[model samples]
Target: MDNTLSRREFLRRAGMLAASGAAAPMAFNLSLMSEAAAATAPSDYKALVCVFFSGGNDHQNTMVPYDLKNYQAYATIRQSIATPRDKLLPLPGLLADGRQMALAPQLAGLASLFGQGRLAVVANMGPLVQPTTKAQYLSRSVALPPKLFSHNDQQSFWMSSMAEGASSGWGGRIGDLFLAGNSNAALSCISVGGIGLYLSGKQASSFTVGVTGNPQLLWGSTNLFSPSYINELKVLMSTNKTNYLENEYVKVTQRGLNTSVQLDAALKAAPALSTSFPAGNSLADSLKMVAKLISTRAQLGNNRQVFMVQLGGFDMHDSLLAKHPPQLKMVNDALMAFDSAMIELGLQDQVTTFTGSEFGRTLSSNGDGSDHGWGSHHFVMGGAVAGGKIYGRVPEPIIGGADDVGQGRYIPDLSVEQLAWPLAKWFGVPDSDRYLVLPTLARFDADALQIMR
Candidate 1:
């Protein structure tokens, strides 16, 4: 082992290798000891669900500014592609803290959640090394995420506090800490979007399930094989296997098999909901599986859980005006159905769902499309949320200005670490142990925490 490679450096290298399709097995070897051994854990039951927009999401339309002044600015920026304000659904009342704004018509499903105090918007958030001002950003004195505006890097940074070049994800780090308590050691974190570095913790990695609901075994239906062959397969995977590589491979396969068994059992035990998810849709189906899993938390013996579901096609580099609406509608309907399922199961207050993306789009349109930029807006929904209000600073729509880097790559007022740390803390992590999950949070001076009940 190279003693000189810092944890951050090691993590970056690991992420790079993993992203390039390397099959490096992650083995979290940290102590199973609880955070600080003396800090208080969450007394209430809670779970965090991350709805990841796989590609860059255009925040310009999702959280629209209906107010006259901001609307004018926004209309000027978006021009022909802007979602008309008349279509925006006005908020029912002043948000909990009195700041209220309407959302695009496509987001009416989430609008209803807002009226019910079940959704909140966190504005202009992205990855940052520290509190970077325009001067520092221009002068290149402040440490910034490497390769800003690149999809791969920003996505990596969003999922793991470490930049796209990082190795260990913050979520994986958190999973490692709680892996010992998970009933299904085969899976502590679950992803509908397949294998990701964020869920690749040292000891606990994400168990992936397809939205199509098929986790087929690598070796299935071997009726032609003799009884001896079946016996050999079983014996090869036994706990006492002596061959190192073969044993490791068998263990990996067995873990996947165990996860499938446990997950299927849990889903079968869950009560069917009256709410119908949209037919033949990936996002809707993913949410349905999440609902089923949450219903069987007791059987799975997980007091805290995190799930990731992704939907792509937000990178509207061209033809955005025509292509954006349908994608937004899909997200809206999927979220609506997911929330309703939670209500039916009476787990509304127990689970919180939030949106994340690589970054935001540029204010100025690139002919028929929007270019990749920084500092995108995000939303959170759950029965426990302080809905109808927007958190963080919404940037002014100015191109090539102080906040806007040329075509509106706005400096984010809130870092993703700042946004996610509180949720992790709420899910039973101690104050002292927060560093273990989000170490880069310290670099950004993102010390302020707590976002929900």
Candidate 2:
């Protein structure tokens, strides 16, 4: 019999066991675990919600250059796809150079949030091991992220620092640190976007739930044919087995049953939200579920939590002008509703929600639409955010200019680590442990963008 366990298998089993309310027996523990125990306790209630736009979003259209000179350049390059200056919703602040930016007309809700100082834009963010300039990129002097411009690879890179097939993500790693602090650590990281690498930690994994439905036990858990059948199933699950694979499967099944019951009860007991989310908006539905979970935090005994929700159809390879508006509107309305819901729960100051994507679309259009590009504009919203401003270096939109590598694919000035650091620090991760959460963070300046107050 092969008794040796692979590293992957070991971590998976350890994570499962941790989620199943057993943490003491793990044979290996990373230094992060030790530091996590000593980390400061979070505030009364705090949560981070990550809204991911699947497929690359055309951020250039989302955050349009409304100033005359910049708009002319953008319009000239974009041609038919450029959002008309009159249709753009102007933002409150100006760029350092006194150029004005505007949100897409569909993003009126987000523009309102900006006006209220509850939202701040983070310009040109992407996955990077370290700062790289266009010169370095053109000269091939620095190591770039693996598999640039590919959808699957970039998505994985954005979520988990590693390219596709990475096991642990930064979010999951963050959860690993604070899981011990929660009464039910399994609930510390929840996903309405399905099981993603973002929520798979070495010692923790996300508890996935349907956005609009209650969690249910497996079919056998309830008596269908006869009561004896249910009893038999229970006995079989509880019985100690000789085969390792069978034993592990049974353990996982049992833990899942236990978790489902707890979550179902807690969700049922949660108070109904007063804020009205737009009906038929999938993103809003996901955020609605997150709000319910947050509302029931005390019931679930969680002080710190991370959530991920998804919105698709951002690819926009063709018919971008025809299709992108509704997508933008859906996201804007959903975000606005979520902010209001947080206020209703009186957690506006405690919860921060941010946007992420695989990558951004190109600046110059490909006749009808744009191709995949790097470094997109994203926004952070919450009462705690240092709002009404833009963080990071906003690049010039000129195609083949200093920022663009080619065809208007801008090099990211800000790494993904920088975007995630402040949220981790605000959630109680100590400065000493930042490197543990973000492996490549030390490569960049330790100064985090002051988005969170």
Q: Candidate 2 — which residues are off by over 4 angstroms?
A: 1-43, 215-233
Task: Superpose all Cα atoms of candidate 1 onto the true structure and report the RMSD in Å to 1 decimal.
Answer: 5.4
lDDT of 1 by residue, 1-453 (tens): 432354335445546323422122222112111222222333344567788886688888777776677777888888877778788887665434444467778888888887777888888898787888899998999888778888888888777766665656766666766665666654557677633677655555665655534333223554212334435544655666575544544565445434555666677677777889997667888888877777777787776667888888899988887888888888999999999888897788888899988898888877787889889888888887767667777776677777887787788888999987877766677777878788777765455534576
- Identify the leading candidate in terms of TM-score: 2
- The list of candidate 1 runs beyond 4 A from truth reads 1-45, 92-100, 212-214, 217-232, 239-242, 445-450
Model 1's TM-score against the true structure: 0.85
Expressed as tens digits, the lDDT of each residue in 1-453 for candidate 2 is 342354346557646334422221211222222223444556488888999999899999999998899899999999999999999998887888898999999999888888889999999999886899989998989988888999899888888889898978888888878877787776777888643688767766766767753422234465321335434555668899897755665565555545555776788778788899999999999999999889888887889898899999999889999999999989988998999999999999999999999899899999999999999999999999989988887887798899998889989989988988998888878888887789888888757598888
lDDT of each: 0.71, 0.81
